[model samples]
Target: MVRVGIPRALLFYQYFPMWHAFFRALGAEVVTTPATTRATLAAGAARVVAETCLPVKIYCGHVLDLVGKADVVFVPSLRSLERDAHHCAKLLGLPDLVRAVVPEAPDVLDVDVDLEKGTLAFYRAIYAVGRRFTWNPLRVKRAAAIAWAAHLRYLDWLQRGAGEAEHDSETGWLNDWHRGLTNVAPLPITIAVVGHAYNLFDAYACHDVLRRLASLGVAVRTPTELPASATRAAIARLVGRAYWACEAELIGAAGCFLDDPAVDALVAVIAFGCAPDSVMMDVVQRYARATGKPVLMLPIDEHTGTAGVATRLEAFVDLLTRR
Candidate 1:
């Protein structure tokens, strides 16, 4: 069986399900690296220049972990997901960056995901990548169809789970989100954590930020979990137009959350040295300042320590509770 390695970084958190289903349908055993840790970050960081962001370094680490463990590593070049939309340099050149940095890596399977070319181009790129695993076009089509269904379902799941994030403290249903929080006041606060999932959800990159916020007895919402219509409308209203692939989610969701009265504050999680993140953070900060809503910008890097993140989160939550 052809063992395919998929790094658990970057788009992995967003598209891993579809990739898993696609590879499985093609009769390949999928090999994944363990969850992010300090060692993984360190190993991957040493291979790249110091200026690289935490997520990219972590991706390199994951690719390194897959060496000698799989026949090939799947690293898609996700240039643009929408028409006329462009991705940051990190995403557009991920496959090449891996090839340059990780010399010991096996074959890296990559497919261009630039939709600006046209709808047909999108299909062609996906099929071309599919052909690498199998020669049968019928099998590949079936796999693609299955993967498409799974992606839609995953999006639906994200929205459903996010919509249900509402808690009724009177009925005692808030206990579910009250884990790890004690000896502190039960402040009924909700915050929108705006950033890419790679930074917000990655344990090592952000020092388990989402869980940390939850443990502070605060409700959390992320861009990926928000409704598509609300986020899209917010984006259109805020900036008039956007050209970046993640703008709709990151910047749009931040705008939506900032304007939401139910949300007390907007907590922006970002990676240090990321150009896109810096722009998004600046936009969010300005909107927040204009509206008088509290905003906390937490930028994580390879040197970010757990104690520091914890202290900052605690301080931020304390400020929110006092507000």
Candidate 2:
């Protein structure tokens, strides 16, 4: 049986089910890298350029992890998910980056997902990926349908407060989310965490920021929990449209949080040295300052120690709780 490897970093948290379902539907064995760990970070950091963002470094480690385990690794080049929005340059060049960094790894399947070209362009990319498994167009269509359905269902599940789990994988991340939501302590403070899905949900990247906040008796709201209409309404308040796709989401979500009376403050979790995030953080900080709301911007890199992060979180929680 053919095996396809997927890295669990970056966009995997957002679209793992779709990828998993698509491969399984086509009778391909799906293998994924383990959750991010200290060793994983170290290994990835050794090969990545010092200037690259932490997520990219972690992703590189994952790709290398699958070197001998699978016949081909999937690293799609994501240019744009919508007509008006484009991704970070790093994401747009991820496939080539991985190939360059891990030349010894097995074949990598590079698929382009640029919806700016047209809707059909996006489908064609998926079709091309599906063709690697089977030549029959009908089978490919069925796989694509299953993938789309799984993606929709995953989104719905997150909205329903079901928390997120890599479909059919070990349940640690999902369990952590649920435990945070159901904490026994009274959560009198509500904080909106605004960032890309990869940053907000990845435990290692943020050093379990969600659980830390919940333990401090604070309720955390992420962009994934917001309604599309609400996000759109928030985006309309911006002076101009954002160019980067993830930055746009953060901007919209930050606006919503700043405008909401129920939310006590805003926390932006970003990767250190990320140019797009640096720009978005400036926008968020200005809006927050003008509105007289407290916003904490936490930037993490490979060198960030968990102890320092915990101390900052503790201090921030104390300040918010007293306010």
Write model 1 residue lDDT over 275-308, tens digit each, in one string: 8878777777788888999888888897778999
For all predicted structures, in order, the TM-scores are: 0.91, 0.94
Candidate 1: minimum summed lDDT over ten consecutive residues — where? 169-178
Model 2 stretches with alpha carbons more than 4 Å out: 163-172, 182-186
> Where in model 1 is the C-alpha error above 4 Å?
162-187
**Ten-residue stretch with the least lDDT total in model 2:** 164-173
User: For residues 55-151, what per-residue lDDT tens digits would candidate 2 score against the true structure?
Assistant: 9988988888898999999998888876677888898898898888889777999899998889888878888998898898899999989888988
lDDT of 2 at 239: 43
| Candidate 2 root-mean-square deviation in Å | 2.1
